[model samples]
Target: MLPNGKTNLIALDLGIHGDPIKALERIVQIAKSGVDDHVVARELIALSDGRAETRPVLGMFLGGAGLADSILYCRNQIYPLGLSNGLSHFLTAIAVLVSLLFGIRARFLPPSSNPVRISLIRDGELAGRFSVLIVTTLEKLLLGTRTGESQRGNMKLMAVDQSLSALLRLGWASLFRRMGKTKMQGIHLEQGDTIRIEGDHSSVILDGELFEASEGHPIVLRSTQPVPFLRLAA
Candidate 1:
């Protein structure tokens, strides 16, 4: 239960749709929000089965202490009075700890890829940049084989030129339309298409498939090989 009594309301609502991606997305969103909201933080701790509690305590301790003072007064300073120096020390510690945790989580749960970049055109044109994360995976029987239904499969697909300008235009237009447009345009790459992604730390080729094709908005893609650079990787 959350401190506000919202016991996974958002996640429950998403689960009603039997969509794991949606559920996970909601979880991440909620977690990000809870970084500041105590109520939400409590909810996350509950949902994560206590896996999310460590950093908050550390945060509270650091926040109550001053960062600069802690560093300078390390020698012969009374242990308890150390917190009375300045708040900067606590803030810095919290930042470093949080960053480390995030890095570890990213390694375990690779980030998602940029939607716009992943759905690139072959003609050197670039579309707007958007991030995609799979919150949940829904199991469905297709031709007697159990397959996962992805968020893209539930939504629309939009295609645009592989140019930054084209991407911006499409992205803004979609945002204005309440993110309802999903039409795969520009270079048409069907399901099972092989493509390469170049990122800051890594470059890899992925087998992309059209998981969801919205009539007029965006096309969701699923990769046979995992790529983590976006918000949601799974």
Candidate 2:
């Protein structure tokens, strides 16, 4: 029985399903009481299981006297689990090293940005709008017309007047090709750059060309069509 009168079964279930590291992080984030104390207590409990008894000994050795003093009363209190101690220490060290390596890798990964915004007007009046973000690169890929499957590596964006149509195409491609296309269009963009529509309707498109007002910095659309063309600003 726990101090809260809950059975060990509950604790076992929680330990098995919940991530200890995440829970500890949440406790620290919330500025809760006895964070260090809770961590030490949970660590002691986790190490006492029949299959994990060697953890306490490994923690004591790796943590050193200072950590042990902060968490426990004396070094003599931590007992090794006989022959299992050597194997357990080796496994623990390997796990710690692997976690550190993954952390470093994650830091170098590319960051994802929010999609661009656009307003939708229908019949010369304001209608609903939508937004979308890019998840992959912009490239041309040939796909089968009948099966709607990629025959080669020719995946490209589809042009549509309505934002919903673009979203539908993306959803279809995701269902069939196992991937989604990036939206590319909206305010203050550059040539060959991709932009996402973020308003009411969600979609993604790529920029073929851009024209800025020379004197007043006003946005000028060369054409309301998606095509590879050149435009010189006046």
Candidate 3:
């Protein structure tokens, strides 16, 4: 049961049937409402119940964190394997930590021949640029796989442990570097930085759901707030 007197979850698939803009706006509204992280998690879980494959629930939590300092306070930070919900929180934690640690990062993936231009915008101006954005795309593409495809363009739940360990040991150090032939770019960004992707107006999958964009208009991604994601014992 949720804190909002709800026994069932709301079907709010942000990037799917719902509009990303409106969904973001709603999340912002919820953030402003001063709701507890547990409540937020429950609502998110309910919202993402049916579409486990897409993992939109994980995306919403991360996207909320990216917007502001929110949290997904869960009762079980770690649970038995039977209760594991696809390791979504753990996977998201790694992605968020990596994003925070690394600035404007993207990896070019194979199999897809097209190149996309991704820019990091700060205060309405270009701050960083990526000729190839592969990491997150590949992460979404390879979701639900038993194992991470490859270290080159794939990320797994173990990354969360890596990020946490790095944080505990290194106390905010820069560790991202350009690797491989693709020349993945990284630009250091301050808090509240916005990432804008402008390519041939192709559709993008953020977290899991697909977002459509036009060539003339760019899709803006922002994480003005850092969301605290709690990991349950599983």
Top of the candidates by TM-score: 3
- Residue-wise C-alpha lDDT for candidate 3, range 1-234, written one tens digit per residue: 111211111222111223445545655665676535423122111112122254322332222112111012211232222344336346434544555455434431111112344453433433222211222211111122112233321121111111334333222222222122221123222222334545453444433344543567655553322233321111
What's each prediction's TM-score? 0.20, 0.18, 0.29
Model 1 C-alpha RMSD to native: 19.6
**What are the Cα lDDT values of the candidates?**
0.27, 0.24, 0.30
Query: Against the correct fold, how does model 1 do in TM-score?
Result: 0.20
* Model 2, span 97-184: residue lDDT tens: 3433353222222112112232112212111221222111122221311213321222222222223344445446545763333443
Better of 1 and 2 by lDDT: 1
TM-score leaderboard ranking: 3, 1, 2
On TM-score, the stronger of 2 and 3 is 3
- lDDT accuracy of residue 82 in candidate 1: 46
Evaluated at residue 199, the lDDT of candidate 2 is 25
Give candidate 1 regions above 4 Å deviation.
1-162, 176-189, 193-234
